[model samples]
Target: MNRFEDKIAIVTGAASGIGRATADRLRSEGGTVVGIDRDPVDDVDMAIQLDLLDLGAIAPTVAQIVDAYGRIDVLCNVAGIGHFARDEDETPEAWNRVIGVNLTGTYFMSQACLPHLLESQGNIVNTASTAGTNAQAWSSAYSASKGGVIALTQTMAITNGRSGIRVNCIAPGGVETPIGEQFTPPEDVDLTLMAGMLPYHRPAQPPELASAFAFLASDDASYCNGIVLRVDGGTMA
Candidate 1:
């Protein structure tokens, strides 16, 4: 179980929820985890206060991690934001922010970490959502961002797989997280349109998703590249 005995990992959105859980999981299994968040993070070997929206700061942040750790074995792009709004009520600013944080941030962070990952022959696990594959009401921006993440994950996998780096994504269903708590459907939302979006069981907890993240990042999945592993409870079924 010491799969990460000498590994170093960077987990984004690590202040709470799945990010925090993923950091804990990797650390528990013997990895040194550097946690990143716009808010303060805890229980990590390193805590980096960063807003993924500040794209300009990403490379410097990655550089700082490489300087301290000398290498990075894993990069978990888990930081994201979303809220439901009627299509007519959604603002361009809101859409841009979601795409900026979720999609653009993931891409640039991967780009920043690529050289080190190439040197270390490491891997990346991105957090996409089941919403990316399945349509839901009041989720145009969220869906677009996650869908982009799915595509980005695959492209990176293809682009880097031969270079000794693995890239994979997890498309999770409803997870009990801060972002989920704040997801209020538009007042006039149609319930029936979302009926199929519900999972077969209760929403997954953060640790469950974290476990999947760990699996994808571990050597155990050395062959699991360019894949979107759906941790949804058969919602897509």
Candidate 2:
């Protein structure tokens, strides 16, 4: 199953969770993967310590990947943060931090990798969330950023399809990861609204969702573009 025998991929947020799972899946299938993360991690062929908040680091990071690989076949934007605050408790700094890393980071990385992706007729698979389309109790900032990612994925798909580059997204509902566990509602925050959010009533394992990422990036999805595939165990159904 060397679906990516000669492929080169760049996966952000590869330090852990879904990003790490996706990287492992691709590498197992024979792709050379360069992982990018804000923190220290050693999970791919090459690991780059990159904080998505640093807009200045995006281009050079892409350049380095391309310089080393000579081509880029896939870019997966899987690194994101979750924010859970009461409406009045949310601050400007907190909102900006979430938006900057999740939405802006996804955009900047896509822009930087577009040239190489176009060259290889590659694809981009972004990690969106069911929170984007559905509602979540304590996730205003997180939901908004994910919703923006959905729109961004569609825009990139439309803009780049003619150039033979594909852009799609996965809207995961409850995935067991560090970020997923980060959604902590205060003691006063009601959990009733969120209780109706998950139909499966269980968080998906990282590797389970990783399979979807692999599918979207592979040639099997050659005709898929701008599609936001929901892997949320009927959460959006």
Candidate 3:
């Protein structure tokens, strides 16, 4: 139960949904969690309202964590935005926003945390999506950004392996989070029809995805470097 006992963790996008769930789960499993998000939230040991798109804010945030916790044992890159725009309809602003938060944010944050993580020989668990692996209609930006995360995870894992740092990614399907809710079919969209595409016949719960994250961050996954663990409930199986 105390898999992360005495460990210091940094979880981004922790104000709500999957990120919030992961933060709570990590703390429950004994990690001292420092959460960051653009919005404010309660229950985190340290919560910072930070906009991930503002890359300049990243290093300062990481410095704050290092100043407080002394080291970061786990870094979960869970901050991201969803874009449901079609290829043609997607504007430059939308593309930038989605890529900025989902991809660039992960890069900047990881870069900032690399030194501390190297000191702790820590691990990173990134929340990618099935869209990263498979094409998602009307979600080009989200898919591309997530794909970048997957690539980034592998690159970091390989680059940091000799240093005893592990990096892995989780590709979740449709989970019952605020982001998932946003994808709900319109009034004209048939729920029954949509249900048939998923093997589980329902969306995943945040806790389910969080559990996978917890495992990846724990010693249980000590050999799981550079891997993409899909938590899509057989949706991609």
Model 1, residue 97: distance off in Å is: 0.6
Clashing pairs in 3: none
Candidate maximizing TM-score? 1
Candidate 3 Cα deviation (angstroms), residue 188:
10
Candidate lDDT scores, in order, read: 0.92, 0.91, 0.87
Instruction: Please identify which of the two predictions, 1 or 3, would achieve the higher lDDT against the true structure.
Output: 1
lDDT of 3 at 214: 95
lDDT (Cα, tens digit) per residue for candidate 2, span 11-79: 999999999999999999999999999887675899999999999999998998888889999999999
Error of 3 at 110 (Å): 0.4
| Candidate 1 backbone overlaps, count | 0
Candidate order, TM-score descending = 1, 2, 3
TM for every model, in the order presented, reads 0.98, 0.97, 0.93
Instruction: Quote the positional error of residue 177 for candidate 3 in Å.
Output: 1.0
What is candidate 3's lDDT per residue for 1-237, written digit by digit as tens? 999898999999899888999999999999899999999967999999999988898899899888887899999989888767645567999889989999999988999999988999899999789889976666778889999999999999999999999999999888877776455343444356454335465678888888999999999999999999988888877
Off by over 4 Å in 3: 184-199
Q: Which prediction has more favorable lDDT, 1 or 2?
A: 1
Candidate 2 vs candidate 3, TM-score winner: 2
Name the runs in model 1 displaced over 4 angstroms: none
